[model samples]
Target: MGKEFIELFEQWADHYDETVTGHDLEYKEVFRHYEAILAEVAKRTFGHVIEFGPGTGNLTEELLKRGRTVTAFEPSPAMRNLAQEKIGNRAEIKEGDFLSFEFKKSVQSIVSSYAFHHLTDKEKAEAIAAYGNILESGGKIVFADTMYESVEAYKQAIKDASEKGFHNLAEDLEREYYTTIPILKEMLEANHFTVSFEKMNDFVWIMEALKK
Candidate 1:
């Protein structure tokens, strides 16, 4: 488990969603925006599902309504509690980090939102490989997250953040980082995932990588 992340997210559990959307002006709609895409995926995908980080169970709520049995790996106890309260026994909750958590059974797809970027490039690769390992053939990873164009773009965003009165947020964004889509594509491809997109833009993306 990532001790640092555990503490950080626990502290942020209450305002996590607001914090993310509020600070990233352009992506405030990402949460609501991803519903339709994931809904489309649930219709097309099959078997059991797993979600990496299910903050307030917003997406989890949608998944349950669509009849997909979901298991969520959310490390923050507070967030997990919030999700538990939000969705009850509708979905299984695993209070652990994705990297440390074990996949007990094979699943059809692994889904996530705004969570993968928490990992470094190497860890992202490892997590992708883990998803591949647990999924049955044809099973995939469907996720939406911040995908920057370059290191410079993220750096510049920091300046823009300060100019917008988000000094603390700018500092935080400065700490957060990402790997470009091309690089993420190569990593997924190398791990035997054929990548596709449900949504694509300069800063964020909703992607599907089918395991081969």
Candidate 2:
């Protein structure tokens, strides 16, 4: 799972909201239109939802406002604490990760925002396959996170980040499991999902994959 970054997330627990709100210039672009992106994800989701990596419960809040039942899984204890503090008893914010979460009820939609990059491509595939097995026909997976259109675009993003003296951003781009559209499409399709993408920002794309 993404537990490897628990320490980092624990350290970032307090400042995470600040970074997402454009307080950190290096990551500003990465989190641009932060609220709107959460809103868009919430709008696309329906019925019972399982949210992976619900950091600080931002999207959880949106989903709750829409009157949707949400069960959020987060790996970091610190992040989970913050999310629980933010969401209260409205939604169950549990300690789990993308590939290691558990829920008894069948869900209509599986959603996430700005957190899927924690898994490598192989892990991503495994997670998708697992979801495919659980979800019935017409169930959906709505995720919004950093993704590139092509390998060249991925490289160019890192280059641009480097040239702009955004070493942290550049390093993060190079370090994370951020992947390309083609690869994700193939993975989703192999798992019986009909996927579509919409660019949310220079660094983020909304992937809506409906299980067939």
| Candidate whose lDDT is highest | 2
Candidate 1 per-residue lDDT over residues 1-212, each given as its tens digit: 34466677777788766755445554454344555554565565566888877877877877788788888888888889999999988888887766878677999988887777778788888888888889999998887777765667777867876887867656656566456778788889999889976554335577789988
Candidate 2 segments whose C-alpha is farther than 4 A from its true place? none
Q: What are the models' TM-scores?
A: 0.85, 0.98
For model 2, name the residue pairs that clash: none
How far is 103's C-alpha from truth in model 1 (Å)? 2.1
**lDDT per residue, candidate 2, 1-212, as tens digits?**
57787887899898999999999999998899999999999999888999999988899999999999998999988889999999899999988999998776678999999889999999999999988876768999999999999999999999999999999899989888899999999999998899999998899999999998
Off by over 4 Å in 1: 17-45, 198-202
The number of the candidate with the highest TM-score is 2
For candidate 1, the per-residue lDDT at 73 reads 84
TM-score of model 2 relative to the true fold? 0.98
Give the CA lDDT, 0 to 100, for residue 200 in model 2: 86
lDDT of each: 0.74, 0.92
Give each model's clash number: 0, 0
Question: Candidate 1 overall Cα lDDT vs. reference?
Answer: 0.74
